[model samples]
Structure formats: structure tokens, C-alpha cells
Target: MSPTPIAWQAETVPVAGIALHLARAGAGAPVLVLHHDIGRPEPSPFDDALARSFSVLAPSHPGYDKSPRPDWMRSVRDVAVVYQWLLGERELTRDLTLVGLGFGGWIAAEMATMAPRAFKRLVLVGAMGIKPERGEIADQALLSYIDYVRRGFADQRAFDRLFGAEPTTAQLEQWDLNREMTFRIAWKPYMYGATLPHLLGGVATPALVVWGREDRIVPLECGERYAKSLPRARLAIVEGAGHFVDMEKPDELAQLVIRFVNEA
Candidate 1:
């Protein structure tokens, strides 16, 4: 038989008065896939792997990718509220398996902390939310594309295949837009908000905290602290990986998620 095609679709839904673009795949229980700060809701290997077992719903958070952005949208918490609205509009309030990556993971944590009962489970991969007591926060916006590619990947060959060529004109334009919006909201504090730590302890959902052992952006210790604070949480460190652990170790991450959600 021919290969079974991945049934993926894209559309816009109204969230916080702005239309947010969402890409979806598969058919089953709903799993929301949140993208990293410098990434969009594209068909990443990690997303593809997860889609094999879940109805994956990946949305370009308000100002990222092609989503419409309003001037009023500011701070990571605002992004979380938009996602909450997105789930409400789509009728995905209950039984949500939220998988957030990098900055998206921060948004996921905020969402879960805000409404602990809404999500059944949460998976944060290389998440950035909790403050590091010692190390200075890494400014992602200041890094060159090559710098990002190197820091995010453990395998150079895989990096060449995924982000090798210079970005296309359209991609460059979108990148510019994403960078502008990211700076507008997240530049002031560098890594986290003042009140995020206080809010994190309130989350009641089962959490799977995945960290890249070599992550430079959000240190592994942050993941340890995040897991320690949550009532039901486990921390998994992916070896030979950096900030983008999901991209570098998709299969391993997928297995962890499958096991966590399946058990719950």
C-alpha cells in the first residue's frame, strides 16, 4: 500500500480579538503543540512523531509566523491568555495535553498555573519560565541565525538538512516580524517575569518537564526546580542535546510524552 498521508490542516481562529493561525494533524484526543520562541508551527520531526499518536494542534502564538498581532498584546502571560481563549473557542477546554517548547513552554506553564483544572497533563520541553538565581539569562534575539542553529542542534548534519540554506525571502520577512514582536514583549526581563515562580507552584496538573542537559538558554537546574515545585511532576534530561531538545531528540521526547499521557 502507498504511504499513509499525514492529514494536516491549517486555519485561523479568533483568540483575544486577533485571528491566530493554527495547524493540525491526525485524529484522536486533542494535544496542543506550542512552538519555541524562534520557531513556528511547522512540521518538525518531533511534531510529526507526536502526531502519530495525537490529534496535534499547533498554533502560531498571536505575533509569531503569519498570525495577526495587535499592539495591546504584551508579556508572556498575554500569550497564555490567548491560548486559553483559543481552547475555549475550539471547545478544547477539558482533557488537554499541552506540549510547549522553549518560550511556548513558559506560556504553557502560565496557562496551567492560571487554570490548573483545564489541562489533564502538561509537557514542557526546554522550557524557560523560572528564574536562574546565578547565571545570566541568554538573549535569544541577539543571537545570529547561525548561532541559533549551532546552539539548538547536537548534530551538524541534521542542522544542515533542517536549517542549512539561508532562509527564503518569505521566511526572512516572517522572522523579522517574529523578532520584532518577541522583543516588544520579552526583551525587558531577558528570561522570565517577576511573578512566574509564585504562580508555578499553583499548577495542579500532572507535568512532564523535559530538559536538554546542555541547554544554554534555560539551564537544567531550572527544570529541576520546576519539577520540584509542582505537586505532580517529573524531570527528564535529554543527553547530547541543547535548547531545542525536541528537535534534536524527537523520538525520545515522543516516547516520554506517550508514556506520560497514556499513564494518566
Candidate 2:
């Protein structure tokens, strides 16, 4: 297979007096994508698909990847505020879309709650923020990087296709960085907020809460919780996917977002 072409223009924009490294691509309205615990690499098929219809902007949350995490940044809420500031800096107070994946979902939920009307549409895919009534959220700290990522896909081949059967040294190092950041912000409570569920009510933006039927990471019940709490949200499922729906089924996920956000 040939090497994937560049999909985004790398840029560093300052928000709230701090610099944010982000990838910007395509054209049209903005779709602010908040990534999961693991920082996503560029040239994603899902992002590219979105780029075809709207501008795709993905930022490395502070303390992850190349971004400089400030000492004041302690919780997911802090990250959310930075993103909200990014929108304000760009004059995207409203008339914009927000998509969050896994851990990013926690950040997105907080942002939407802080200013519900700021986003016109919201999509949370296999998000982790609320505690489940039945099962527990998977504890990634207890597993190796490979083991943790393996749980995200229903199909092992999909994992091999994306991260290789054996990840490289550089990849492993990046995984460590991701783990460190995840621990910094999402620890103690272990990938959840006690008040997130209670605060989700009355959001003005329409939301699409998607989950993988086979997800062993964050249980499907959490998705239901998100749907139930958000006044204008619907729950959707990808049959064979796990927590990493975008990695396992990018096109399907993209299609879901497009259809939901396009609806009158």
C-alpha cells in the first residue's frame, strides 16, 4: 500500500494565553473534534470524510503529544474551557459542531454543559465520563498499552491494521505519554465525573450518542446514560465495534455524524 497523503495543515494557535497544536483541514463550517486518551495521528479516513463537507479541526489536548500542558490544568473541565476559548477566539460561539471520542467525550460533555448553546450539534462516540449502573468502566491503568488498545476493537485484525501486530518503539513511547496525561486529568475518579450526568440536562444542541455493541471498555450503559440525560440526544450503536468506533468503523461513524447533523 502507498503512503497516506497529508490531510491537515498543522498550526499552533494560542488560546487562553497558551499555545494549542492543532490539525486543520478541508473547507466549510467547523467541526471541532476532541480526541480520546491516545492522541490521534493525522490523515484519518473519518476526519478526511468530514473534511469533504466541513472544516475538520482536531487539537492535541494540553499535556498530550506535542502540546504543553500547564500546571493549572488538572481536570477534564480545564481542557473543556480551553476548547471553549478556542471557539471564542475563532468567533465560533455558535453555529458549529463538536465531536468527542472516548476520553474526549468527557471534555466535550463538560464544554456543552458550561455553554450548551455554543455548539449547534454534538456527537459522543464510545465516550467515558459517567459511571454505569450495571458494569464498570474498563481500567486502562491495569493493562498494558497493547492490552488497553486491543480492548477497543471487536476485531483483532482491525487492531493489527491500525497499530500493527507489534507497535514500534516510537509508538510505545507515545502510548506512555498518553497514559501519563490520562492519569493526570482522568485519574482518581478513573475516567468519569460524578456530576457529569446530573449536569447534562437541558442542552440546546442536538446530540448523537454512539457506542459499540461489543465495547468492553466503557459499557453500552454509559451511552444510554448520556442519551437519557441530554434532553435532545439519541443513542446509536455499531454492531461489531468496541470502544474505538472511529478506528474500527470510521466511515460508518462519519456517516452517522453527517446524517444526524444534517437533519433539520
Candidate 3:
């Protein structure tokens, strides 16, 4: 298979008193991507694909990667607020699409609920933030990154592309930092905000909820719950994919995203 194209430029953009390392590319409408817990601060194949049609903004969460995390930054709500400030500071509040995956999806959902009018389109992929009435959202905190990948992807090759057979020492340290940040933000509520579902009904932004039919991490049930809670949202389940749908099915996810963003 050919390598995924690399076109984005990595740079640091100051936001909320600290600098955010982000990858930006493309030239049309803006698309902000809030990455998952395991995602790094750099652009991925998914970002590259989205950059073909839209300007992709993928930022490292405050506490993750090289970004400095303020002591006060604790919950997903806090993260969401910081992002709102970031968008406003950059004047990107209008005609923008917000895409979130896994933990990032949780933050994106919170942001949507907080502003309701900030984004033109919203996409959540295997998002976490709502407590399942029946099953449970898998606790990735307890699992090793390798184990997490194995569980998150239907195609094992996807894990190799993202994590490799063995992580370097620096990679391990970065993974630990990312995992620690994940704990700080998600451990309290165990990944769900008690009030998020109630608030989602007020979000009028059109949303597309994507999930891997066999996602063991967040589960399809959570996606269904998001679809039901959001006032205007549709759920799409990608068969043979897992929690890491973006990595496992970048082209497919990008197509869904483009279609959703283009719709009236």
C-alpha cells in the first residue's frame, strides 16, 4: 500500500496562556480535530485526508504531549472551555466543523453543549462521555497501550501502524504522560459527565456520530446514546472497524465526515 500523504505544517499556536502544538493544512473551511487519548500531538493519516477539502486543525490537549497543562485543568468541561477560548481567540467560531475521537469526543461534546452555536458541524467517533445504562465503556486506563490497541482495532495491522511492535523509550515516556493526562481528566467520572446527556438535547448543531460496530473500548451503545441525546444527529457504524476507526478506516471516515459537513 502507498504511504499516506503528508501535507500539514506542525507549529505552535498560543492559546489560553500556553502554546498548543498543532498540525494545520488545506485551504478551504476549517475543521478542528480533538484527538483521542492515545493520539499524539502531530497530524495523522486522517488529518491528511481531511486536509484535502478543509483546513485541518489538530491540537494537542493542554495536558498532553508538549503542551503545558495548568493545574486547574481537570475535567473535560475545563478542556472544552479552553478550546472555546482558543476558537474565539483565533476567530474560528463560525463555519467550522469540530471532530472528536474517544476522549477528545468527550471534550467536543462538552464544548457543543456549552456554546451550542459555536460550530457549524460536529462529528463524534466512538466518543466517551455518557454512562451506558447497560454495558460499560472499557477502561483503557488499566490497559497497556499495546493491549489497548489490540482491543481497539478490528484489523491488527492498524495497531502496528500506530504503535509499532515496540515503543522507543521516548515514546514510552510520552505514552505515560498522555495516559496520565487521560487519568486526570477522565478518572473522576470514569469518562462520563453526569449532566452531559441532559445538556446535549439543547445542541442544535448538525452532528454525525461514527462508531466501529465492534469497538470494544467505548462500545456502539455509547454512540447510540449520543445520537438519541443530541437534537440533530445521525449515527453510522463502520463494520469490521474498532475503536480506532480513524486509523483503521481513514478514507471511509473522511468520506463520512465530508458528506456530513457538506449537507445542509
Candidate 4:
């Protein structure tokens, strides 16, 4: 349980007339890390671990947290386009790996579907966007703090480490704003689409779908469905983990991702 030693630099890249905040570290092949609906990209343990071996970039999606949002940019497609622009601005055109968690995974899937050749590999962890036959993914914005803590993690102690104890007023305010933006974009279908099946089959990049065996928010069945639809995809279930598997099981999750990237 030593604190991760990776050093990250804060960057602001202009995309679609707004300055987007991005956290970056390490070197070698580029790996982009997308945060869940919770946002606040800096404290991500999974990104830190991945940065040890690869150049990792974690961007705060427009309208989330400290990132500015344009009035016209609505829908997940808009977010995906902005991310693509950001990558272009950075000149990351080859050997790109996109890894996303929860709602971020939805954005990643959309990005891959829109421009599959832009990325070399895709990793979706506890992803949402594809509609399931039964039950619905929980709208994260509506969940109370206690409810989020209970449903998001397999180990409750990981909550204090990820969210921290006695968060400052400013931190809480940012968290609220992040949740609001997430709800604004994702609340319509309760975090899914009926047309996702058609789009998923079109993604050409190799994909890795990682799900927590105990995930209640987005069921494990959804992960299986996502893998089955994609032409090049594999599914892995992490036991003793919930929706936020990366936080509760960072070491295990990192190992899985590293192996996948190497294999791909």
C-alpha cells in the first residue's frame, strides 16, 4: 500500500473552442484514460498504474468538473468528437489505446464506433451504453453519497482512499457539478441506447471488456453482450469487485490491462 510514485502534469488543450483539462504521465505508446460519470480525473489510481509503462492521458470531459462546455455540445457523440480533436491536437495518431470506466466507457465505445482506425485497442471497464434485456443501469447522479459508496465498491475501505476523508467544500462542489453534467447527458435513456448493438458491431479495434463480478450498476451480462457484438473483443470478470473495480482492485485491474495491451 505504498503511494504511487508517478508524476503527472496538468495540461489544457483547446478542443471545439473550449480549454479541456488533461492529466498526463509516463512515456512510450499513448494510452488515454477516461473517467467515469464521477469525473475528477486526477485521483485515478488505474491511470497512475498504467502510466508506469505507457504514456497515459486522462482528460476531464467538457462540461464535467473544471472543463468548460460549449452551449451547442450535447450528446455522447459530441463528447467523442471533442476527444478525437484533443488527440489530433496532441498528434497521437498511432499506437493509441483507449481505456474507459463506466459512463466513460460509453464515450469510448462511441468514439471507437465513430472512428475505429483512430485507436489501436479499446478497454471498457464496467461500461454502459448498450441496452440490456432486463434491469437498467443506475443513474449515478441520483444516487446519494452513501448509495454510491455502497454500490460502487466491493471493499468499503477503498472508498476512504479513493474519495478521501473530510473532503473540502470546494471538492464537494466540483463533485456535484460533475454529477450534474453526467445526468444532463446520460439521464435520458437511463444510461443506455437501443441502437448501440448496431454501432458496436462496426468497431474494428481490438477490445477488452472488463467487468466486476459483483457489479450491480451495470450487470456482468452487459459486458458479455458487448464482447459478443464486437468482432474482436474479449471479456474478463474480476471477482470481489463492484462498479469501481479499478479503485477497489487497482493492482489486479492494472495487470489485466497491461497484459491485454501487450497481447493486442
Candidate 5:
């Protein structure tokens, strides 16, 4: 017998004056997903897989897609605070599992540090919040669109999703807007907070750092650093994947998350 395919329920909710475009589904426990820089408000394959076990709420960050970016949202920490307000407003502070990917992981780290007691568990996939002491994070800003796409996935054929079909004008505009917001929040510190590692040490929430073994953006070492820094954190390296581990290995990542959350 085959399994049922999970579908997402979309919504536009106002949180602290911000109208957040959210995609959600499933019923058991709450899992909030903070997305990467180029992601949209709609549900991806990863979201569907996650919904099989736990209710998943994935929000497009402000200035991405239909979500509005406030003038004051200049840093990852600012978004973290807004999300804190979001969880409280939705009354989803208890028994929650928080997942962040790439750029989103940076925001999630900030949120966990700000309110360590709010969530039951945390998952960071190809996350970037701390500056690497040895290797450098890939400079996405400098790379051409094709090059960036090529480096994102372990399988280079995935680049076709971006370049194979010509993008519509609207898609191009949204890409520009998302990039602008990324620069605004991360440009100064360049994708990492100077004190983030120190703050992570104080986080008591159990966290799982999932990284792609061949990640070209944020190195695997960053995942190791995160696991070592957080009070109760561990690392899980998924093979044959790159920076977009969730996209490349959605089912595997989902199983890993399900196992972790179930154990808690």
C-alpha cells in the first residue's frame, strides 16, 4: 500500500505588525521552519515530508515573496525577536520543534538563544550563524546566478530548476527583493554574528545540527562547531548532499528530525 501525500495549508497572519505568509500542515506536534535566502512562501518537498509526522509551519521571511519587510528589520537578531513575538501570538511556545535551513538557521539560532525555554527541540540544516575560524563561507553575493545554483546542490543537475526554464519577470523581481533583504540583514556581519557562538553556549534546548557532507557554502566544520558549542547539541552529516540538505535529502532529513523529536 502507498502512503498519503501531505498537503500544506497556506495563510497570511499578522504578527507584531508584520503580515507573515505561512504554509502549514499535519497535526501531532508543532514544527516551525525558518527558510533559506532564495526560498519562497509555498511548501517545498521538505515541508511535505515533515508534515507526515508533525505539524509544520514554514514562513517566508520578510521581504521575500508576499511577506513585507519592515524598515527596522536590519539584522538576523531583529527577525529572531519578531519570531519570538510570533510564537507567543500564536500560543505555540510549548512542545515546539524549530527547524532552520542555511540563512534561516542563522535566525533560528538567534531565536533559540533569546528564548531557550520556548521550544522542545531544534534542527539546523546547513546553518550559518558563526564565522568559521578556518575555511570561509561561500560568497553567494559575488557569484553569478548559475554558479551559485551549481554550488548549492551536490548534484549539479538541480541547477536546471533555476536556469533550465526561463524565469518570469515576477520571479526575477522576487529574487532581487530576497537578495536585497539578505544583504540588509547579513551584509554588515556577513552571515554571522561575532557573539553568536558565545550565546549558543548558553542555549539549553536540545539541538541537532544537520549538514551536507559536501556543502560548498557553509562548511561541515560549522556544523561541528555548532554541535560543540550548544549545551545539548549533536551533529548529523547527510551524505551526497550540499548546502541545501533539506532540498536534496528531504526524506532522510525528515526521518532524522522525526527520530530526534520522538525521542524527546
Candidate 6:
């Protein structure tokens, strides 16, 4: 397959009394992508695939990266609400698709529960929100920022591909900013949402819950619970992949998402 030349260009978009650093590309129906705790400062292969079929909107969540954080915003739900306004302003609710990964997945899930029928389809990849019935979600606060990131990949080579064995000082600093923001918003509850599962019951959006088979951070049980809670949801486990599927198996993961989003 020929590589796509599509690339994201960051721009400042003012919405809901905040200026968001948004990266946009592609053309077609809208797909709003929510980044993880570390933020997707660069485009993922998954996003590139989606751009072939949809207009992609990837904005830095408030307080992460270039996006300014307000003192008032303190929860994942708050971030979800901000994106809702961004969708409203852009008139993207017409035929929208929502995709969130890890922390961003938590935000996407919150938004889906909040406005159940707003999106055409929902995709949550190795999302962190609900507490697992069996095992505990890995504590990001306890580990070094790099260690936390390393824990997401299935193996060392995958980790090195995204963030090399010896990441530059700039890369480390970026992760530092992201970690602080995550600590600020998700500290009290860690990563899981206490009432998120209960709230998901009424969400009518068709959700595709994708989890890496080798994910060791967020337990697989959380994905199972999410699939069980939503009115219309199914779970897909990608073999040999870890929590960071975008890094470990971007093309394969993208295909799964594309097929799900295109489903009738």
C-alpha cells in the first residue's frame, strides 16, 4: 500500500472561552480524536488511515501540550465537555465519529454517556476509565514518567520505535508537562471513573472497544466491563499488541477501527 501524504497542521482554535491547540487534516465526515495522558504531539499512523476516509480533528486537551488549562477544569469529564463545544462550534455533530485512546478514551466515554446519540460511532482503544472487576489499573503517579510510558508497550522494540531507548531532553520535558496535567485532573480517583459504568448503560452509540491483547497497564476486565455496560458495544482484542496499539501495530489497529466506523 502506498503511504498517505496527509499530515496534520497545528492551529489555535478558540472555543468555549479557551484557545485550543488543534491539529487538523483530511476531508469527509468528522472524526474527533482524543489523545492519551501524554498527548499525541505527533500524528499516529492510525490517524493517517482515518484521514483517508474522514476529516480528523485532534485537539490537545486543555492544560496539555500547547492547550491552556484553566483552574476550573479538573476532571476528565470537564475535558469531554470542552470537546463537545468544539464539535458544536465546528458543526461536526451531523455525522461524527469519536475515537479516544487511553486517557482520551476516558474522556470520549464520558462524552458518549453525556450525549448518547450525538455521535455516529464511538471507538475506545485501550481506554482507561472504569475500574476493573478483577485487577487494579496501573498507578501512573507511582512510576517515573518514562517508566509509565514504557509499561504501555508490549516490548522494548515497540517502545524504542516511538520513544527511543534514550529519548532527547525535549521529549522527556514534553512528557513531564503531560504527566503533571494528568496528575492535576486524575489524581484523586487515579484513572477510573466511579460512576462511568453505571452511566454507560443508556448510551446508545455503537461503541467499538479495542484493547491490546498484551495490555498490562489497564486490565482487560475494564474493556469487558465497558462492553457490558454500553447498550450497543463490542470488544476486540488485538493479539501481540499492548496498550499503545498505535505505536505497536498502527496499521492493524487502524484497519479494525476503520472497519468498525464503516459498519452499518
Tens digit per residue, CA lDDT, model 5, 232-264: 999999999999887778789989999999993
TM-score of each: 0.93, 0.96, 0.95, 0.93, 0.94, 0.96
Q: Using alpha carbons, what is the TM-score of model 4?
A: 0.93
Estimate the overall C-alpha local distance difference test score of candidate 5: 0.85
Candidate 4 wrongly placed segments (more than 4 Å): 1-4, 165-168
Tens-place lDDT per residue, model 1, 120-226, is 89999888888887775577677875665466766665566666555566656666778788887787787587788787777889999999888877878888878
The CA lDDT at 154 in model 6 is 88
- Name model 2 segments beyond 4 Å from true: 1-6
Per-residue alpha-carbon lDDT of candidate 2 for residues 1-264, written as tens digits (9 for 90 to 100): 653553688899887666888888878778988888988855477787788778888898988887877767789998999998888888976678899999999899999999988788999998999998899999988999999999989999998998889989898889898889888888989999999988899688899999999999999999999999999999999998999898889889989998887888
Candidate 3 residues lying further than 4 Å off, grouped into runs, are 1-4, 41-43
Error of 4 at 114 (Å): 0.8
Candidate 6 colliding pairs = none
Note the Cα lDDT for every prediction shown. 0.81, 0.88, 0.86, 0.83, 0.85, 0.86
lDDT for 121 (candidate 2):
95
lDDT of 4 by residue, 49-89 (tens): 89888999888889887688666766777788888888887
* Candidate 1 residue pairs in clash (backbone atoms < 3 Å): none
Give the local distance difference test score of model 2: 0.88
Candidate 6: list runs displaced more than 4 Å.
none
* Candidate 6 lDDT over residue span 1-264, tens digit each: 779578787899897677999988899878888888887846477788788888888889998888987767788888888888888888888689899998899999999988999889999998999987788889977888788888898887978877789878988888888888888889878898899988998898899999999888898888998889988999999999888887788888778877888777
Measured on C-alpha atoms, candidate 4 has an lDDT of 0.83
For all predictions, the C-alpha RMSD in Å is 2.0, 1.7, 1.6, 1.8, 1.9, 1.3
Evaluate residue 39 in candidate 4 and report its C-alpha lDDT on the 0 to 100 scale: 74
lDDT of model 4, residue 87: 83
- By summed lDDT, the worst window of 10 consecutive residues in model 2 runs over 1-10
Candidate achieving the largest lDDT: 2
State candidate 5's TM-score.
Answer: 0.94
